[model samples]
Every structure is written in C-alpha cells, then in structure tokens.
Target chain A: MGILEVKDVSKRFGGLKALSDVNLSVEEGTVHAIIGPNGAGKSTLLNCFVGKLIPDTGSVMFEGHSLLGIKPHQINQLGVSRVFQTPEIFSELTVFENVMIACFAKRDGSFRLQPFKTVENETDIVEKAEQMLVDVSMIEKRDMHSASLSRGDKRRLEMAMCLAQDPKLLLLDEPTAGMARADTNNTIELLKDIQKQRGITMAIIEHDMHVVFSLADRITVLAQGTPIVEDVPEKIKGHPKVQEAYLGTAH
Target chain B: MKILGLNEKDSRFLLIVIFLTLATPVLLQPFPEGSGMAQFNAGYPDLMQRFAIFGIFAIGFNILFGLTGYLSFGHAAFLGIGSYAVVWMYKLLDYNVIWGLPLAVVVSGIVALGIGFISLRRSGIYFSILTLAFAQMMFVISYSDLFGRFVGTTITNGETGLQVYGNDPQVLLGATEPSSPHFFGIVMRENFWTPQFGDWQFTFNNGYYFCAVIAILAFYLSLRIFRSPFGLMLRAIKTNQNRLNYTGVHSRPYTLAAFVISGMYAGLAGGLLAAMDPLAGAERMQWTESGTVVLMTILGGAGTLMGPVLGAGFIKYFENIFSKINDNVLHQWFAWMPDGLEDAIVWVLHFFVGKGWHLTLGVLFMLVVIFLPGGLVEGGTRIWRFIRGTDRKEKTADATHQPEHVAYVAEKEEF
Candidate 1:
C-alpha cells in the first residue's frame, strides 16, 4: 500500500463532471507528477486530496484512514501539507513567525491555549524553524515581513512553512506557475535538494514540461478528467495520447 | 532579572505601567487647589477609580479584537452580567466585595463561552453583528426585567438598577459589619489620605488603590499573553485564517478562547465598578457602552501592550474633566480678553468642551485614524523617530542593502 491511496474517486459540480473514476497512489519516497491540459481537473483532484472538497464517490485513504469528513487542519495533522498556487502565507507576520507558527501547530496540534509561555523561549521549535529557513535559503530574510517579500521569496517562505511541519505527503499545485525562469530553476533545485535529504513523498501538479522531466519519478498525464497515460518520464515524453490531448487531433 | 516570569523588556514595561497606575492620583492633580486650572484636576476617588476600571476593560477588549481580529459588539452584556452578579452577591451575603468579584468572572466566562461558541461560526462583519444582536437581546431583557417577571421576583431590578435593598437578607452580615461594599472590613469608598503639598492637594482613596492594583495585574497578564505562542497563533488568525488552518492550527478555538478571556476582563471591571459605587445599572449593558471600548482600543493602538490603557485613561480624563468645563468656566478663562474677543473665544471653544466633549473626541478620533492608522502609539513612534532623526537615515540605509524590487515592495507596505 502506498502512503496516499486515491481509488476510483469521482466528483461533479452541478452538471459538469470535474473528476471521473480517478485512481492514483504515491509511493513511499518518490516525486509523483500529475500533468494535464488546462480545464482537465488537475486542481480539483488536488483539492479533493486535502479535504477542501469531498469526492462524490470512492475513497481517499492516507496511511489507513479516510481523508473525508474532516477539516483542513485535521488533514494537516495527519502529516499532509499542501502549498497553494498563489502562495497563501501570513503576510502581516515576519518570515520567522510564519515558520514558527507552522512548527507550533505541528508540535501542539490544532489548538493549545498556552497563554503564559513566551514564543521566544520555545528553543526547540525556534531551532527547527530557523533550520527550515536555512534549508530554503531564507534565514537572512527571516526578520523581514512576509508581505514585503518578492513573489519568488513568498513561494520560498510558504515552502519553508510546509517543510517546518515535516509533513509525510507534500502536495504542490503549480509550484512554479508564475515565476521567472531563474526563480523556477531555483525552486526545482530546492525541491530536488529537499527530496534527496529528507526522502519526502511529494505529489506535484505541473504544466511546465522542463520541471516535470527534471523532478518527477513517475508521471501521470490526465486528459478530459481521466488519466490518458501513466508511465515513466521517458515514455511520457513521446506518448501519442498526451500529444493528442495537448496539440489536438491535428497532430 | 525577570519579575513574574517576564523578560527584561517586558518586566520593565510592566514596572512602568504599575508605577504610572499607582501614581495617578498625584499625577492627575497637576494644578494646585484654588488655582485657575484646578477645574481640570481629576485626582478625586470617583474619576481615578473610573480610569482604572475602564483601563482594565479596554485591555481585555484588545486581546480579542486586536489580536484575533474578532470585533465583538456585545461585550457590554458580560459587563452588565458582572455588575448584576456582584450586586446579587452583596444582597445575599454581606457587603464584602471579595465574594462577588470572583463570581462575576466565573459567570461572565460561562456566558462568553456560550456566546463565543455561537458567534465564532461567522467571521468579520457577520461575527460582529451576531455579538451585537446577543447584546441587544440581553439589554432588552435586563432593561425591562423580562427574566424577573418570569421568575416573579426582581433580579436585575429593571430601570431602577440592582442594589442592596434595606430589607434584603444579608446572611453573612454581622452586627458590626460595614454597611457599604468593603474588602472584608476595609471600606472601598473611604479616602485614606489627602495630603497638602504647597498649593496642590492629593487624595488617595482606598477604592482607587484597589482598582489600580487589579488593573496592574490585568496589564501584566495581557503583556504575557502578547509574548506567548498562543498570542502568535491569535495574530496568525488575524493576518490569514486560511493560512493558519492550512498550517494545522484551528482558528475557531483560538478566537473563542480570546473572547472568553476578554469577557472575563470586562466582568472584572464591572465588578470593580460596583464595588466602588455599589450600583449596577442595566445601561451598563447598552450597545453604546460596548462601542466605547472598541474606540478605546483603536484610539490607543489596538495590538500594543500599553495602548489600550492609555486610550482608556485619555477618554476617561476627557469625559470627567473636560465635560465639567461648562460655559461659565469658559467665560471665566476668557474674561482676561476684551469683551468681544472673549465672547468669540468662548463661543468657539464651547463646542469642544462640556456637552460638546464627544464632538471633540470625534474630531480627534478622525485625525488619529486618518494621519496615524496605527493609532496614538503610531503617533508617539513618529514623534520619537523624528526626535531621534533616524527615520530618514534608516530608509536610505535600507535602500542600499535591499534590491530595487524589495525596496519597492517595502515602500508599498509602509502605509
């Protein structure tokens, strides 16, 4: 059994079918990339995994438990972390505080009314947060307000926050969607380094062919809300089905 | 060294707050008695006690609204509940204040829990409206004695207000016990000292000291909460509740906890108000009363440690001293000028003092909100930075170290 098992999951919104009978599993320590054309339900599938939306049918099992009928925070406490497309972060707080709150949530679980103990005195959590910032090459900007961070740096800070949680299964939805070439390359290297060091299981949804080929261990290509091909990157590079899905029947 | 588990900076801040609170009677009586400016002196027991009481109220309100960004418009219900609880305690037991104060806190906390659980389901304006609705319902109930009519007995005593009646049972009362509200045998209303120094006279009332001590404790507790991990989570809720939830932090419970804590703070203030004056009015639960604390928190500096206290003192000072300056007092001051010029001065000034005190407060609030979005604390910081001549230097220094993109982003976020 894989760490995350999504079997025969289907969802519909009014008359439109967003996902139909999708089945995928992320192995223990590998980068699983899901690539698809626009309007192919990539984000909808990712949302289903994080408890943001419930599938109309089938089961999403993490380890041995169901991921449905629970809150976003509860799913996170189950060792699953998701990075958003637009980088959802605490903009009013400092970079260090953004990571520290993640660390505190990881340690204290959803809710702990610790009104007396000072945040600076939590040496263990502080050490972990600072180390995460260093790993993301953001330690120098730790004191800077997260709102003032550049878009690329904001993405890095969000990565540091998720990493601070030490999640078992990391979900990335277009991690380099709107980045410059240099920023995208930096993010690719950062992910590669993190995967090599921690062996963290990641499931990335990407449209960038270069990023997918460089980072994905196993690639799943979906067309019209259904998987058209599931194979290694080398095979997916020359697949006729993926070509037809992306370039139309004229190809 | 740390005092009360606080760090050096926090401990120092607490010490300063305590010193200022305790020295209020002496400090407020700046002008000597029989002087022209003596009308502005607010060193009497009544006003000093009010400053401390309202200071505690604002500090607690800040913990919820300032930290979690949950603006509760019905906090006055808890305050009214506290007053009723204390007054009931006095009627049942003796006039000793010790029994009623703790009961007030407990009662208000329970009420807050019920209200917070329901109100926290909504965020932003919806949450505020829910709280306001609950408080309005409570006010109607208290004002018209709805519950009392149901029970066939006077509970809140309706419009006349709740007080210790002459024929009521005082089971804990002794023949020699003090008649009014007291801490054991010590009367809260009695003035312990009135020392005359040169032309100044300072009155140290037992009731004011009692309220001041509790206010100091409340301030210290708030300071600790501000530095705590829970406090960070609360701020995280304010900034981005979505991010907080994704980070595995439950925002609802944190907001609820803050609500209960602030309600308890309001309750304590209410109880103290009753202890000093021995009266509990239904008007204390009015929606306008709730709005006053919101104004205090925002006017002072919402999230800062000392801001609420300063805001409370400022408002209370103006309410008491400024409102006392009637047309006659204005005329007396302007009498030195020529008759026509004096009339002009007093006429213009009349709109800012006495019955028009709220107009002055409204104008000042507008200026603070417009020019200083961070409140009075921001104004103070700006003045301090100007005095030190470091604001311009820091901007230039930052421009050199940061990239142009970063500098642009920083400038955008400055406001």
Candidate 2:
C-alpha cells in the first residue's frame, strides 16, 4: 500500500466543488507530482492532506493513520512536513535557530516543556541542526537573520527545515513558483540530490512543467477539480488527456 | 568558567545582576545626607523593598508578554490573589512569612492556569481583553468580598482590606515570636544596620535584603528561561506561529506555561508586599496596577534579559522621587531665575511632578516608544556602542554591504 492514501475525497466551498471525488496515493520513497491549471483544486487537495481543510467526503490516511480533524502540529508529529508556496521560516530568528526548532520538534514530538535546560547544552540537537545547515550549504549564513536571506536561500533553508524533521512524507506546494530560471534550476538540482540521497517521499503540487518533469516519478494531472490522468512521468509528457487538461479540448 | 550550568557570558550577566541587587542600598544613596539632591535619594527601606518586589513582577511578566507577544492586561489579579493568599495564611497559620509566601505562589499559579487556559483560546487583542475581563471580575469579587460572604469567613474582607485580626487563631504563633510579618523572628520593617561613609548614610533593612535575594533568584531563573529551548520556542511563537505549528511544535501549551510561570512571579511579588506590610488591599488588583507592569516591561525592553528590572526601577524611582518634587522644590531650583520666568517654569513643571508625575512618565514612554522601540536596553546598547565608536564602524561596514545585509544589522539592534 502507498504511504499516503486519498480515497474518493471531495471538498466544497459553499456552492463550488473545489475537489471532487479525487483519489490518489503516493508510494513510498517516490516523488509524486500533482499538477493542474489555474482553476483546478491543487491547493485545496494539498490543504486537506495537512489538516488545514476537512474533506466533505472520503478519507485521507498517512501510513494507515487518518489525517483528518487533527491539528497541523499533530499531523507534523505524525511524520508529515509541508513546504509552503512562500517560504515560512521564522524571519525574526537566526538561520541556525530556524533549523534548530525543526530538529527540536523532530526529537521532542509536538511538545516538550524543558524550560530549565539550555539550548546550547543540548549537544545532539545543536549538532543535528548544524549538519542540516551544512547539507543546505547554509552553514556560513547560520548566524545571519533568516529575513535577510535571498529568496533562493530562504527556500533552501525551508527545505533544510523540512528535512530536519526526518518526515516520512514531505509536501511541497509550488517550491519554485516565484523563482528566476537560475534559482529554479538550483532548486531542481537540490531536490534531485535530496531524492537520491534520502529517498524521501514527496508530494509536489506544481504549475511549473520543468520542475514536475525533472523530479516527479509519478504524475497526476487534474482539471476542473478532478484527476483526468495518472501515469509515469515519461507517459505523462505527451499524453493527450494531459494536453486536454492544460490547453483545453480541440475547439 | 560556567557556574550554575550557564555559559561564561550568561554567568557574567547573572553575577552583574547579583552584585547590583545586593549593593542597591548603597548605590541608590549616591547623594550625601542633607545635601541639595538628598530628595532624589531612594535608598530608604520601603522604596528599596518595592524596587526588588516589582522587579520580580516585571521580570515574570516579560517572559509571557516579551517572548510570546501575549499582552496580558489583567496580571494584577494574580498580584491581588497572591496578597490575599499570604494574608489568609497569616491569619490561619502565624505571623511568619515563610508559611504564606509559598502558598501565595501555589494559589496564584493555579488561578493563572485557569485564566491562561480560557484567555489563550483567543490571540492578539481578544486574548488581552479576555484576561482583562477576568481580572476585573476578580477585582469586583475581592472589592465586595463575595468569596468571604459565600464561604462564611473573612477571605478578602472587602474594601477594608485583609489583615490579621486580634481575635483570629494563629495556630502556629509562639509567645516569643516577634509578630507582624517576621522571618523566623526578624522583623521585616526593622533595619538591622546603618553604615555611614563620608557624608552619605545607608540603612540596610531585613525585609529589603530578603526581597533582594528573592529578586536575584527570580532574575537568574528568567535568564535561564531566556537561554532555554522552551524560550526559543516562545520567541518562535512570537515571530511566526504558523511556521512553528507546521514544524511540529504546539504553541498553546508553551504559551500557557509561560503565562502560569509569570503569574506565579506576580504572586510572589504580591506576597512579598504583604510580607513587608502584613496587609492585603483590594486596590492592589486594580487594572491600573496591571498596566504598570506592562509599562515596566516595555520601558525596560520587552525581550531583553535586564530590561524588565530596569524598567521597574525607573518607574518606581519616578513614582517616589519625582512625585516628591512639589511646587516648593521647583521654586527652590528656579529661585535664581527672574521671578516671572521662575513662576512660569514652576507652573508648567508642576504638571509633570507631584500628582502629575504620570505626565512625565507619559512623555518618557512616548519618547522611548518613538525613538527607542527596543526600550531602555537598546538605548543603553546604543550609548555603549557610541562610546566604543563601534556604531560608526558598523555603519560604514553596513554601507558597503548589500542592502539585505544592512537590514539584518538593523534588525539585530532591535533585539
């Protein structure tokens, strides 16, 4: 069975059906891309996975545990980490602190009240946080405030934060949406390296064809709040159904 | 180099705090006795005790408001609860403050848990209003002695305040006990030593030292909290709760723990006040008292380690010394100025002194908020940097760097 399973999931916003009868599963240790045009329910479906939205019908299970009606932090503790469309690092804190928080969460679960213990004395956590920064090539900027980082650096830091959790599933929502070509290529390379090294299961919702084609092993194409095509990346490249979803049916 | 599990830098800070608190009686009495500026001297036992007590209160409040950015507007209720708890202990147990003080902390912490649980359900202004509402309800109950009426005992004793009655049973009282809030027979109000140096005189009292020691302990604990992982989580909450939650750190329990801890601090302060005076008043729970701690925390520097203590001392100094400056004091200072100019100046200055001391505080608060958003600690850092000429060097360095790096430097100064 897949690590994450979505079965006949449907979500509606008042009169509009944002996601309708959507069924998808992400296999273990594979990059699964959910790509759609502007009006499709890509974000809505992703939100449902993260406990930001409750589906109107059907179930979403992560490793056989239901991912519905729980808080975002609880879902994260259950081994699901999400990267937002915009970088969501703690802007007021230093880069080291931003990653250290994720490491603390990973080791301590959703909550641990260790008020008397010093952060500097926690040797293991400090080492883990430093290693994560090194992995992201952000060790030099660790002392610098996260807010001052360039957009590309911020994205990389966010990725490092997600990876620090050692999450079973990583959800990426348009990681390269607002990046320049060079930054986008850098992100693609970084993703490829992470996939090769860690074999992390990633569910990416993307509008970028380049990112999807470069990283996704399995592709699911959605149109008008419904999935129309599901296949491997090579098959998805020239599929008529995918073209129909993107460019609309002839005439 | 590391004492008390703290790093070298933190241990140094703690040592400095301990030295300053212990030497307060001497340092505060810089003016020689009977000198022209003698009126500014705040080394007296009553005021010195107040400085330490409120320092503890503000330091505690800073953990919640400063770290989590949870602005509580009803913390005074905890203070009142603490005072009442101590007084009740005195009535039921004995005149010794040891019995009452710990009870006060426990009582206040329990109460804070309830208040924090309900208030924390809402964030931002709603959370503030919720705490305020709870505090006001507490004030009304204490003011009217509603609890006393329901329980058929003198709990708060209403507007008359709660005090040890002659007829009440002091079960633990000994015939030889000094009575009237003593620490194992050492009277709180009595001064044990008065040392004179040149023209300056300093009086060291039993109660001030007690409060000073407690305040130092409280400050040390706060410093530890600031460096702790939980403290980092609280700051992360302040900056970005959304990111913190998605990272698998729950924000609610952290905020609640901070709230309860700070409330216990307030309780300790209140109990200390009662221990010194042996009286609990309903007025202690007023919203104005709640606002004062907020002022102290912000005035000192909300997020800094030493800010709250400095702010508490500053406001207390103003409340006592500046308020003592009346029309006569103003007239004495401006006597040399031409009569009309002196009269005009005193008339205007009078509004900022005496009962109008709040006006001076208001102006100072406005100036700090506008020019030094990071409060007195930032101002101190700036002046220190200026003296070292590092600020100029940094500015030059910043000018040559990329724009984003410059923003980083500026933001670092605010912390």
* Location of the lowest summed lDDT over 10 successive residues in candidate 2 chain A: A140-149
Instruction: Compute the lDDT of residue B32 as modeled in candidate 2.
Output: 98
Candidate 1 residue-wise lDDT, B212-316, digit = tens: 999988988988898899889988887778878888988888989999999999999999999998899999999999999988988887877777888888898
Docking class of 1: medium
Number of the predicted model whose TM-score against the real structure is largest? 2
Candidate 2 residue runs with Cα over 4 Å from true position:
B392-415
| Candidate 2 accuracy as lDDT | 0.90
Residue ranges of candidate 1 with Cα displaced over 4 Å: B336-338, B392-415
Which DockQ values do the candidates obtain, in the order shown? 0.56, 0.55
Model 2 lDDT tens row, A1-251: 99999999998899999989999999999999999999899999999998888999999999999999999999999999999999999887788889999999999987889989999899999999999999989899877778778999999999999999998999999999899999999999999999999999999999999999999999999998999999999999999988988888898
Q: Cα RMSD (Å) per model? A: 4.1, 3.8
Q: Pick the candidate with the highest DockQ.
A: 1
State candidate 1's TM-score. Answer: 0.95
Error (Å) of candidate 2 at residue B61 is 0.4
